[model samples]
Target: MRASLIALVLALSAVPAHALPPPCSGGQVYEDRNGNATRDAGEPGLPGIKVSNGIDIAVTDAQGEYGLDYVDGRTLFIIKPAGYDLAVRPDGLPARWRNLQYHAGPALKHGGIPQRQPDCTHFGLRPQAAAATKGELDVLLFADSQTSSVKDVDYYWRDIVQPLVGKHGAVLGLTLGDVTNDDLSLYPEILRTTMSLQAPWLFIPGNHDLDFDAAGDEDSLRTFRHHLGPDTFAWEEEAATFIGLDDVIYQPGQTPSYFGGLREDQFAFLQAYLPTVRKDRLLVIGVHIPVYEPGARGFRPADRERLFAMLEDFPHVLLLSGHTHTQRHWYHDASTGWHGLQPLHEYNVGAACGAYWSGVKDAEGIPDTTMADGTPNGYARLRVRAGGAYALSWHPARGTDDSGIGLHVPRVLRKGAYPAWGVFANVYMGDAETRVEYRIDGGEWKPMKRVEQPDPRLLLENMRDDTADALRGYDRSPEAEASPHLWRGALPTDLPEGEHAVEVRAFDRWRGERSARTSYRLQVGEP
Candidate 1:
């Protein structure tokens, strides 16, 4: 009798008296190394990582593990970190850090990383319709739209953000951090403008967005979270899992403006969630600061190893970020194993505000938004295909008519190879006259190609104001005997073969010579 009663009790327990249908099917999961809402490797489950299929309040555990039982089809994602970067798969999905040689899909999906496609497509790339089954989806990327005050906000709207309002194609749009220029209050205005995008818009914090009054590290971003919601969170769209993290950890005594490390809370959150990522969907990480090195800033050697180790297993991963306000592409080879088998694509986008709104205003009354390195003020569009192919393009803001941004002569000797040797380049001049040249081992500076095409908008900012001379320095002079937008050069062969310095100079159609020539280092073959 006793054994039968015990068996009966066990059976009863197995059959939940009320068989609530499983929450949702096809839901996604991720490995959270840190249990905090952030996706770091230390802390456990967090307060705000987003989960769908009926919105169960999701939090990570002390062990950084979370299992939303029966959430099969819902999208699960992490809030991206601020200073850190997120990894992405080729299909526009978020790539897991582990096994990252390729995506997590079938055998046909894997391949070595290739050079990133340029962002030359239309200023706006549409996302695949939610119902569409065949082609890839699309995502929109904007680097720092950092605005310091209401006036800057106006510039953003009138010059850049306003133009993107009602467009379609990308299901979601991401701003790569530095949403404001020390004005957290402007976040709402920023969102209001971004909401015009008609898609889910997400943001990451930048060094300028923190609070200067927080008394302790625990509450540093209190006002920010209270207003901006969670600093980091995730969402799923179509076949991709998206994680947003707050990597801007503030030091106890440092001024809020100082930038240093990722908070332990975020790491705790990631530890709890990473293991639960769904096997089918691609992972897309959206963060503000770059996990990889920006050419301008060199490398963040301390956090690199920790970050790589936490995400080493994922097969498909792409990291997108903006901080340097320049255009750069970084590719990591598989030899050192910084990540899994997949090669990581680190895209550091140029700023939307364009050199801190540095130059003169055009007919639109907006400043010329071009970087010192020559990347014009613009936003990027990322497209993700269902089969796992992704592409990127840029949409430059319309600026001046005299000059614009375009490709420089392809370097025979890469940048920095020769200090004195420089290349001349130009933009927006309407098939205008141009020239180029170089010398190696003290050879003559021979002219190269004078390629010209329709100038992208970013390359043509603020042409109307001949009266004010704010950005007059940035103007290219076509007649100074030396081109501001063009370079003439070949590396001096006398330098060491391993790598040498190369200098580039340019003159633009505006008849204004640049303040200085641009220079970069190049690698030479050992004889």
Candidate 2:
């Protein structure tokens, strides 16, 4: 994949200075069965694949040919058909589209009119092996690898990327957004690091990945496009249809700001595209921003409402996003304008560079970048069954165990005093359906109350930083925010003065029970 990308770049760079092709008005979609990356005799053409030019949609014919009225400045791409996979660059980026731009060097206009390309720009697809077509797929999800400098990139590789280097079980990978921190030039390095995972990776643009100097939202991602592919595209794997939408709208000016909302063109694209998907397949939408408002920010309600309506008919659907740098689970139903019988489940997966890679360095010289919500900076695994059933789990960057519960308890509490202490558990991938229970010293298990509050561990970490005489680490971590996966239960105050074990067991809807244990001491009264 890497070699193919380098070759394509060299080929594009070698185009004669004066020999620009006519406007690209059409293309062909051929099957490259021989793995030669080109059309050959006896290789059949693929039909029913959707091709688009931003505002208009076209389908390829039985001959694998497609034509569209030339539209300068509009990106041209094909919606990868189900049961097939596109060839990707070494960095796991899918090479399923053509830019249609004539120029190829740095002198190319930034946001000015895009140079037109020649007609008959074609796309090719390599057949996926039958073994690769297993109805089940494991997708790796990484969010907010917001590395700001070379050192930060190194930290990302050492701490986050290196752990999964040779574990190639995942069929696909996705970065929710913010692949880098404002420096678009670092995309190559980031891509190279991601390539180590050896899975086809999909990326969504975050606010930090934008070319802020661009004139408007339409061109704010020029630099991102030069490195990555189209801002929006879709593909399929097994029983799921994956759609990536660029929902960040750049407001260019002296004090530019980005908002989360789909542009009219994106809405049009979905309107034309969703009807083509089979109803039984799970619809997984990936965006950088959450659809519903979070505190004072988030995507526009109108845009979210329209999107929900579009998926109302689909029984199985999931939305994945990452921008807040926090891990959370949300359910949108009638109250949230979702018309589907089953509420839409949105998983705001945690970031790879937790707390922006801030905190003290570890023994390996990697930052102890735990997210503000107490989720360790890590990646997620999404397992989708052949029948559209799915399960999501998070893996800490350095742990081998699958215990998803993080327990917090005071080291010593006064015996016979009021029950002022409580046991807190942060169930990383938990949702409403998850059940959490706790027991003390092998006593009867009691259910814990789910709480929408900051993780106690994170709050303690924040306190430690706030009370320090000076900065304690590379940077102070972000303030603790209310975490959606937290649960709390009062600890018994009558226990004898001695060390006692506290066990927390959590049962997720899909993943079975997982238990974690911590010990706390009950001390004789002093105060």
lDDT of 2 at 235: 79
List candidate 2 segments past 4 Å from native: 1-23, 90-92, 103-119, 254-256, 294-296, 525-527
lDDT of each: 0.51, 0.82
Q: Among these predicted structures, which one has the highest TM-score?
A: 2
Q: How many clashes show up per model?
A: 148, 0
> In candidate 1, what are the lDDT values of residues 240-355, reduced to their tens digit?
66667665656656554344345554566556556765535466666666766433233344555566676677765667778777665556665333756667766677688867
For 389-445, candidate 2 gives per-residue lDDT tens digits of 998989888664569888899998889989978999999988767899999999999
lDDT of 2 at 327: 87
Query: Clashing pairs in model 2?
Result: none
Q: What is the lDDT of candidate 1?
A: 0.51
> In candidate 1, which residue ranges exceed 4 Å CA deviation?
1-135, 255-257, 279-281, 294-302, 333-337, 399-527
